[model samples]
Target: MGRKINFIVLTGLVLVCLLLGTEYQYLETAQGIDSGDTAWMIVASAFVLLMTPGLAFFYGGMVTKKSVISTMLQSFVALGVISVLWVVVGFSLAFGDSVYGIIGNPFTYFNFNNVTVSPNPAFSETIPFLIFALFQLKFAIITPALITGSFAERIRFRSYILFMVLFSLFIYSPLAHMTWHPDGLLRKLGVLDFAGGTVVHMSAGIAALAGAIYLGKRKEPIERPANIPFVILGTGLLWFGWFGFNAGSALGANTDAVIAFANTNLASAASMITWIFFDRMQHRKMSALGACIGAIVGLVAITPAAGFVTIGQSVFIGFVAAVVSNLAIRWHERTEIDDTLDVFPSHGVGGMVGMLLTGVFAKDVGLVYGETKTFIYHLLALCVVAVVTFFGSLLLYKITDLLLRMRVREDQEHRGLDASQHGEHLL
Candidate 1:
């Protein structure tokens, strides 16, 4: 049955690609394109793409040795799955014509029909619209990859692929539309997400929580990181790629990008330092794992405010977010909910902190600047996003499970997902 289903899907995808082949002829570079900006954006897109494999390492190293291969593949597969999906209809569903400010018309840029090399002034005037779409594609890819951590080691690989597609289409695209699109509901309401604190990190984190809850506990919930060194390597790659993640959102080689770059570094540094010291204060050892997690939390917290807040404010945001998320992890340990790798504590809570602080410290519009409206809107948007992502993800998980069982069999769980699901194991 699974083989038949895979064959049918593959056949349909091939037909769709053939039908869309003519659309590629429309691709042409337009005048008024800035070479420098275009170069930077291309590099930025590549940098963002690298983060996915980096994520694979980051996640793989955190799971037990028996599950390492399966865990890493979960993140790695998104590169193939989401890239194709985005080109097919995911990009349109995100950046296409706004449909009532909540979603995009799927036909607006169907199969890259009008997504040409010409700059779309609405997105970025200096770079090709195709580049813009691809840049956003990287974000779409990573969001679902991030969720795999919550259910790692026990999820059936095929079931997860289905869930990833559903999550990207239903959850990720709409949120991207509502947060980043010019006609987006939240954007019009004065919400300021310079990067993806809300759209990517928050949505992934919240959805991760739903997944962990829906999937329940792994049969063996014990965690013994497979390789701490891989965690360090992944952290380094993520930190390096994040400059593009935050600064590239500026859409140009401009002052805002420079400011964002500086803020990104400062926040991560402060959070890393704060996290280790905070552990010391609690009589815990300052392990390298903690440092890596702390740096990531800082990155998540700083994302939304990177281009909007001052350097000093970014550091403060990182400091506050690290302490809060560290506390969140400790609190989570008390619950029966098993979120492998603590995705909710790190990305979810960190994103929330960043979103709220962006409201407080955003230039000229923050609470500290005496403007109440933006801050109020941010609070409201945060609630809306949380409710939408959590419940929506729960629904998607249910639907996916109904279509195909989501979890592995008990024996398979005991044997580890790498060998059971993929028929392969790490050396």
Candidate 2:
């Protein structure tokens, strides 16, 4: 009876918060809202939202049947968890009034307070501020979901949830604030991330490495993927959604969006071809898995430079990133650390390659344009992000472990996370 009462009270409190957010209004009027830009942004936001489900299939098809359900759930659950957190506080911490150029003042937009239907010049001058906030929310959702692949099949579901919350609060919000906020430290320093090479992919990839190390190796031997068809299907969806992911960052239906859209497809194609070629050289056969991974590496590599570089430069970035990530995966295999899906090699290395290449190839400000200042700033920002994400992730993992044991027991692992953790089975 007491437990039921507590649950009721908690539910009531949540309802009240929602009510307050809905009734709230900002009286400020935005100038020159464009219908075309608004329409494009709405579609783009939906496109970005779809990537989480696409990622579910991408990781789901790679794990054993016994863990398939659990693996996919990690990505699916983030849509719900992060979405609510974003409306409540995550958005404020990321884009609210800037505090010392490091983070947003959480109270400025708490529970969606003052997030107006009219445009905010700080983010987008032509779209509703609410729409811009929602668009950014999708990016936040996927960033943590990206980490699940590293610890799949071994993480306790409850502990994983707790860790996701912590990671979102401590690691993701600050990075997003520092990179995307108008007055952010990195932004002020002239460190350019056209999409999210550093903020999303690099942070997720490095955290994946930390999670894999902290959890140690899985006791069970790695097995062949249960379903390649799912992987292919996922790859297709991710590729489709990426158009919005890259182009939508432009915040308008403009030339930059068009350029980003074209560059996205070009880079992905080049990377896929290069990856298969490498496979043919090493194994004498092209592979579907190789093609999909190569395509994803290309997408990841081009994300940061999508709007800044030309189609030709994007192709070059894709090819180079594929080569580097493929080698990183090979090197990772030899190490004692077990990163289940090679998230770090593919995302971490790919994002780094994109960031560096952006400094070299970006229009007007690139090293190729005889400007070294932008390149030097990018290098400095890369080191800062890499160091902060690494140590911060390591600390978060430790704290999560202390509060809730991160690893499942041996018997639970043998039974698999789906059946043991959630009482479900894939096959």
Candidate 3:
């Protein structure tokens, strides 16, 4: 099996190398590109890319010491897997010419043939189309990484790599096309996701839920976090990168970007406070874990509405989302499904709350403004996304399980993934 997998991977790499030879000409024009926006976007792209590693640390510290390295590697590997996939067909399937408003034509940007430094007026008029694609690629990279937390300790590393690739191409790409593309069905309905409440957080969260249900429980259901300091460092990095994640969605350095940046910080702050205080109300002591989770949930909840809502609304969004997700965690604990890190509660529920609140608080067309259309469409879009992501992910998991068996052997689980899967361990 190892030899077969290696052969398949190498063959694919060779095919990609051959395809690169077809593009003999380069696009050298930078017409109509704004230097200011371009510069910030380049920085924003890097900031967003940092988040996957941050997530690696964030998730790594929450598992048992034995599972730590494997957990972190799952997140870190997406930086390689998704980057390559995105450049090949993932970007085309997402932002290529619309195929019935549901998906993109894969051939439109095959091998990133036409994706160049020149501005694509349909997506962004100010920055180069290449920058926009790179920024969106970061979002894609972190998404499947987020799902790793759900089935963390017991999943086969190779199986996970396969699942990640499938999830990106089929599930994540369609959602991105539908939500972000100009000709997308959801976009036409005016479902506003300023950053990625719908595309990133919500999809990852629901898929996490599906994964937890599918994978069932880990052998050792309860374990202490491996390292709290790692969690803190991870949280700080996520928070810092999120400024780029949300603000950069504005696609230019303008008033909307400023507003999104402020709202991002304010929402996260409010959510952190709300999370810890709410824990106290529940007779649970406020801890570093609680604070970190709260901050992340706030970031997730405010993502869709980052540019569409005000600072006060963002605060409210964060507070409400934290409370909801906190309760969700409690409910999940009482159930049979073992979401290893509460990925669904923190990301899925938080995203749902954010998407709904964006419908309520979006500047002009929100429920608060007495415009029912946008809010109504948001509800519809949420339901649609939930069904597609949840069911689609389950099917993909089944396919992957058949192909490579998603879970490891019971003996392997007992030995810990660090040793069983990777042949490495912490000192």
Candidate 4:
């Protein structure tokens, strides 16, 4: 009886195995690959890519006409330089394996090996990893471009090139590594800069402050800004491109991206209305220029928190940010900082506000969604980043000056960077 039972069981096992093999083959034949996620990332990358030119115009219009083209060109040129560097080494350093809580290791992956479409395991499982690196390159390109506005029309172009090359390898790459990488020092420390508040704005802002101080004041008080109409056009592009900046940060075509998109608009609209009121209250008039500036300020402040906060919360945050940033810019004018184009006030101060505000408003804190920090964590992160970036940039400026004796000559400042550096004049 025992032998007969064993024989029946062995026969049944063989038949079950055969059925399982047939089903596996059928499933494979029925299903195919999906590319929806890939398409989204490509479109998102293109949108973020245009922001550099938009930035050129934004910073350019704020300078004297003679230096306007030069300021704008600086932004334009960085795009070409950073784009190549990004594909070659910048991406590897940013997304590579973390080394004792410092920078990344670059030897791994198809990166720098002259191969296209090497997959990264870091960003998202569904999206092609190359898409991940490309999206971030856009952010890296714009951060330093934004800083050019601070030292616009004054710094020598040759010095500027050296500064950018070093800035990308040393300053930008390491900060991005620490902030965004899964194993970065700041990320492990629980700093949540969703869309580059610390990495892009805080770093750029503090860097701008250091450059403003190191370069010394402009030869004359920034000739009361030229071309208000041009300023208006640039502001429009800034507002439009900012949608890509905040929304594409979602990285997926899902509900989170939609919420981020909506919040961006809410914050900017609220900022505009509130700023107009503030101007009317203080100066007894409503100015178009003030409204445009206020809207941009609001846009900057909401960036870090756009995907994390509510629409109502964004409205309040935007209003307060505009008021505070406006006050800061005015205060800066009174001081000796002389931040040309107000880069420090608008992007720097506004970003700081958004970073801290993200802590107050960041909603979910599930294991998958990442750690949820209260306000204290955000403040601590902000303080550490601000101090480090300020000193880091100051040291860089001193080193460059010591070696090359950089910074534009006084006569060049009087003549403008456009005429002196580029040998062209703005219309």
Candidate 5:
């Protein structure tokens, strides 16, 4: 979910409600100190922002040196591309007032009619709406960027630009509504993703699969990572930013936020150690890349449950999610599919694990307003979304491949995509 969940996302919008579900004239009415939560949110926002660059480094390092510049360019591609789209249309299409449980109506495109800075009725209605829009925009920006890695070495720049537009406008917007909007199908089914397990991470992972299949594999899919150190850098920066990703979901400086922050740290630590221990036992030496991957798995696992579960529960969630994703990725390697970054097994499988565990581990964490049969609903929702996302992704990949000759030609692939597609050399 490392797009995380709605815990903070939901809490930050409750303009008319109080801590105890009391009708409140002012969310800041109590101590009048929005200082702590507001300050934390400010920091959390930065953390989340940093993750995008971190992702660029992570993905870029995995591509062949010849394609390094092209790979890194995708991050730039997302930064420039999604930012404008979010402001002009993407925001309204997602968070706009619902239109019968479909896409959100464009109630405020181009900041149309000057949408007020009023707080949403969902959180505390204290944080400004602009803040909400920007926060979610950060999410929107990073997601399509995530998919770029799968197709990194071969996709035509023009085709990718077109795909990005359609993805944000058609695919991302409605899906966001389907889960985040009040009447959304997932929400209506009692699904509780505090952030974006299904909406962002799962969806991106699926789309990554689609993009990979459509763009086809790298000219040489077997090329080792260009810089393992860069992978470590990617892992480090991502782990650091995740604090914001999970904790910021609370959107305020509260106990829930603190719980999220701590869980993010702990789960990653546990996962890193577990992967090192398990892999070292199987092989002779521990691998830095494996540990970093383990840490990422930990981050993905705790995303849905960061605010919902106890610390002890967090350890369990991280462990289980890592182990499952690890096994799944190994299984994936034996197949014909060439996911350059293994986004599906890692993010997709890990996200499913996180979302389902959220159902199982959600507790009466005295912080949030309502806490119910936490785990079961999460599990069911995870299964349903996984099925939909997986099948939907497969169809899209097939259709796109059929129409566009998704994969690079074998001759070009043998020559390396950077040279084959771009008429340039790596250096």
Candidate 6:
């Protein structure tokens, strides 16, 4: 019944969009747009859009059966919630005219006012600004969705929704503006984030860590994944979608895009191999879970450096990230905090490592080229991101709690979020 209602609502929305007459009105610019670049960007946007559902499966598969629906719903809902939010004000906050280099002027693109079919050379020379905005909307949608993994099966849906809105408005917008906007502070400082190592992964990962700490532990923690095959399937989807996540940052079908695509695959393969081998050496047996986690860690580690580093550097980045993240996960297991999906280890730590490695291995401007300036700025940016996300998430969590209790009741938790929160259960 609920699914039917949702489907109807979505269908209505689509029909409305169609009826309103969506048309491409290209603004005249001195620089002409390229069809090839536009076509690739169109495909790339779809690829990036697929990742949220891919993440839904990945996170959904990691939890017990009872919480599966709720967990998956958390990610799926972001598609609706953030998509609406992004168009209304989120895009302007993220990519509008620069305001003191900290945020975009909301009025600049409020309701996507000036966004058109023509290229915005300030952002991309070939792709339409609307396409670029939509591409970025996908990123905004995924970042908050990524946090659901940490506090899965425990958090209240209302609180999560509120927090997602607040986080998007406050945390994500500023970071995106500072890092990606031409006159933004981080971009001016020469911070290299080809993709969203700092903006997406790191921000989500740190916020996850804060939530995990705040939420404490699940009453009865399940050590084993409920469905290994589901996890494997999710991992495969995530891997497939990641090409867009990394390469699509190039915003065109060019050399940088090609390099990013190749680097993404190579790094993931290297990390997977390294993770299983490391597990075999340490525990006397390789685990499928380790392989999946390693693959994701590699993907995260390579994102910031995807277009900046050489293939060899990408392999190194993946291998080292796998090792470090593995250790971080192991250490986290021994602690009291319950990060349900090891979000901090895999994404938070991997993103940090990737950002640092980008400083070290980036072509022409890396530490290897004696460019200590880029390296130092990266460190500073990492610290700023860490502090902002951590504290900001904490504050948002508290505010959400005040408005609506942040967690399900103890009884509801024991009953499982699927039945308790969604009134559904896996048969």
Q: Write the per-residue lDDT of candidate 2 for residues 202-242, one digit (tens) a residue.
A: 99999999999999999985589979898999899899989
TM-score of every candidate: 0.98, 0.96, 0.98, 0.87, 0.83, 0.94
TM-score of 6: 0.94
- Which runs in model 3 stand beyond 4 Å of their true positions? 21-27
Compared with the true structure, what per-residue lDDT tens digits does model 6 show for residues 150-195? 9998998867887899999999999999999998899999999998
- Residue clash pairs of candidate 4: none
Q: Model-by-model lDDT, in order? A: 0.93, 0.91, 0.93, 0.77, 0.72, 0.90
Q: How well is each residue in 1-427 modelled by candidate 5, as lDDT tens digits?
A: 3123224435533531232243323333333336566567667778888888888888877778877766766666787667767766688888777777767777544432333355566544456555667777777877777777767767655446546666777777877877777767667766667767777788777777766665554546645788888888988899998988888888787888899999989998988888778777767368887888899888888887788888998998888877888788889889777788888888878878888777766775222326454455666666666666556655655554454455556776666656776677755
Q: Candidate 3 lDDT, tens digit per residue, 2-54?
A: 56986898899899878877862456867899999999899888889998999
Give the poorly placed runs of model 2, Cα more than 4 Å off: 1-22, 26-31
C-alpha lDDT of residue 311 in model 4: 93
lDDT of 4 at 80: 75
* Candidate 4 Cα outliers beyond 4 Å, as residue runs: 1-34, 109-111, 114-119, 365-373
Error of 2 at 167 (Å): 1.1
Better of 1 and 5 by lDDT: 1
Task: Kindly report which residue pairs in candidate 2 clash with one another.
Answer: none
Off by over 4 Å in 1: 26-29
Off by over 4 Å in 5: 1-36, 108-114, 215-219, 365-376, 394-427
